[model samples]
Target: MSNNTNQAASDLQRNELPAKKPKKSKTLQQSDKKLPFLLLTPTFILLAAVTIFPILYALYVSVMNFDTFGNSSGFAGLKNYMDIFASSTFWNAIFITLLYTALAVSIEIFLGFNLALMVSKDGKAMTYLRWLLIIPMMLSPLVVAVVYLLMMNTDMGILNYMLQSIGLPKINFLGEPTTAFLSLIFVDVWQWMPMCFLIILAGLQALPRDPFEAAEIDGASKFQVVRFVTLPMLKPIIVVALVIRTMDALRTFDQVFVLTQGGPGRATETISFLMYRASMKNSDFGFASAGLFIVLIITIIISTMLIRFMNRSQSA
Candidate 1:
């Protein structure tokens, strides 16, 4: 009887034991590891097709010579680049591009920072105002340029009409070199200031309350606190905004195209406009390609410098 009872308990224990799971095969494990990469293959291919391929082709074309009819005539062996560098028009475009970028970005940063500071406090009116401010940025640059073009018209435009009503002289906004350049800057600042404001406001809101509390406890003045504490904390965010605006400003085309078309004696001709003229109007694809590479190099250098500065600020 004891042996039979022991046998019955052993049987019960054997029956209650869980079944072992099957081990995955080596091939199956390898496939599982590579699954993510396989899924991402399509995205990589698309990026290469759209971005990398064009860049490579442009580099190739930059070395070759193209006829006025857009036919590739043999390799020019850097003649295109030499000619572009030798051209005074190219230098002028570079100067205009730099001036526009610097002025527009600086004014945008200053106005955006002040506007952000003013509206940073919590209130319904501030909320509505913030939305209204963002509306300008949301509009397309081309659309904004077109609207301003009409408004700045000297004869019957609203701006000129208003100025006349106020007994002020009618100003030729886009017809004159100085006013045209400044007008472009004004339009750029009007449209993009809100971008900086939004970015800075987000940064301000994301900042830790501890520092401000500590400043308050130490009886620090508002100006001192902002200069010492807020500015230091906001450096990275400001640099990010600066880099974005700088790159966009450097590539400015629509406003110049619509408002001035590189007119008024090339006063507003940006590098982009110059390239457009070279390729489209002159049909010199090789020259345009070379110019594009030069612009690319300049952009990379500026971006690298800004990034290094940001890193240094963060480290310090």
Candidate 2:
């Protein structure tokens, strides 16, 4: 009986002992360390194919002369870039692009902030209005341009018809230079203001209630609260909105294509439209590529500055 009891106790102790883990091989450990990079290989390959390859090709083409038939004709060195830089049209396009970006982004930011402030409340009506406001941005830019093109037609368009009905002379909206530029700005503001509004409204919603509550406790008026507390906190978000709109406005092509086609003697010719004309109209691919590189450099600089500002604001 004592031997059987001792045998049972030894069996229980053996069963209760922890099992030893098998050691991983060196190769397996190395693979585990590299798994994240291996998983990202496909994404890196895709970026290389789409982005890096095109940029490199553009750089190559920018230095080489291309024939009218789109065949590479020999090395042209910096001739293409020099020609583009010397052209008055190129400078004009740059100025117009900058002007458009500044006006559109500023107006959009101003109107969007006000609209967001007006509707930043808890109600079904505000929710529905927000959805309605975002609908314009959801439409395709080309489609918006086409719609405005029809509406702005001078002879039989709705705007002119209304003006004539009110005993006013029909005003040429797109036929003139200043009106055409302003009209383009109006269209851009109409379509993109909602994006700014949505972004600012989201920022407003996400802002901490502590500051506002504190201001209220101190018996601050609404304007004082907004001026002191709201604007400072919302600066980063506004800058983000500005950066996005500025980049987009700088590359505006669809509206220029459909509405003006850089008409009224290049009054509204943006850099993007100029590039299109260089490549498609004049068959000067080298010039177009050089222009593209210049624009790319400018865009990179602007975006870097904006990003740095955003970082500083956040850190502060």
Candidate 3:
């Protein structure tokens, strides 16, 4: 019996399998480390060529002088920047750009939030209405400007016709300074309010159900719920929308260029339009580069501040 037991134990020990070892070869490890870098190399090279190269070239151009017939004379050592800084037109362009940004962004945010609140409920009607609202966003900015130009024409315009039919005086929307500025603002609002509306509406819809339930249990009023709970929750989305819109607003040129050509006496001339005129119309690349570099610097600072603000909001 003892001999039989020992024989069974020996057979069991002989049949058991050994544990497998993990693969730890140096070649496999090296390939794994190189894979991500190899994948990123193409993207990195493209960015350097497209973005970095142009910026560096522009910086180089900004400090040079242009001779008659539009050739670079030589390095001017910040003279172009000094000249641009001393010019009143540059300051006016800056002021107009700021004014345009403030008014357009403010109106869009206000009207968009209200519109979002109105259409936030889930329904087939809302879905169709959303499609309608996004139509302007789908249209090109230049196309929108051209359409508005036709609509606001003095002799045979639809808006003037409607006013005349209603016994109201026809307003020259694009031919005067005050009205032209207002017209630009109204046009910009018409084109971009939908973007703000869509963003805010999405934010409203994605709101967590628990908070609203708690608010209801606490018997919070509708206004209170929106003011305290909804707005607080929507802050991050609002900041994101604002940053995007603000950056685009700072570089507004396409619509204004196609519509006004910075006309009606520079009323709607933004910094971007000013740059276009300097480089393309006037054939002064040095001046344009200097002014645009300043704009680029300001844009960088503003973008940094907005990113920092977003980080703080996330942390809070």
Top candidate on TM-score is: 3
Instruction: Give per-residue CA lDDT, model 2, range 1-316, as digits (tens).
Output: 9999999986776677664222335567778999989999999999999989999999999999999988999999999999988989988999999999999999999999988888887667569978799799999999999999999999878989999999999889899999999999999999999999999999999999999999999999999998999999999899899888988998999999999999889999999999999999989999999988888888899889888988888777
The TM-score of predicted model 3 comes to 0.90
Clash tally for model 1? 0
Instruction: Put down candidate 3 lDDT per residue, 1-316, tens digits, no spaces.
Output: 9999999986665566342222335567888999999999999999999989999998999999986567999889999999999988898999999999989998998899988888787577579879998899888899999999999998898999999999999999889998988898899999999999989988888889899999999999999999999998999988878888888888888888877888789888999999999988888999988998888888899899989998877677
**Between which residue pairs do clashes occur in model 2?**
none
TM-score of 2: 0.89
The candidate 1 region of ten consecutive residues with least summed lDDT is 17-26
Which residue pairs in model 3 clash with each other? none
Cα displacement (Å) at residue 86, model 1: 0.6
In model 1, which regions exceed 4 Å deviation?
A: 1-29, 312-316
lDDT scores of the candidates, listed in order:
0.91, 0.91, 0.88
Q: Relative to the unseen true structure, what is the C-alpha lDDT of residue 289 in candidate 2, on a scale of 0 to 100?
A: 95
Q: Compare candidates 2 and 3 on lDDT and give the better one.
A: 2
Residue 54, candidate 3: how far off, in angstroms? Answer: 1.3
TM-scores for all candidates? 0.88, 0.89, 0.90
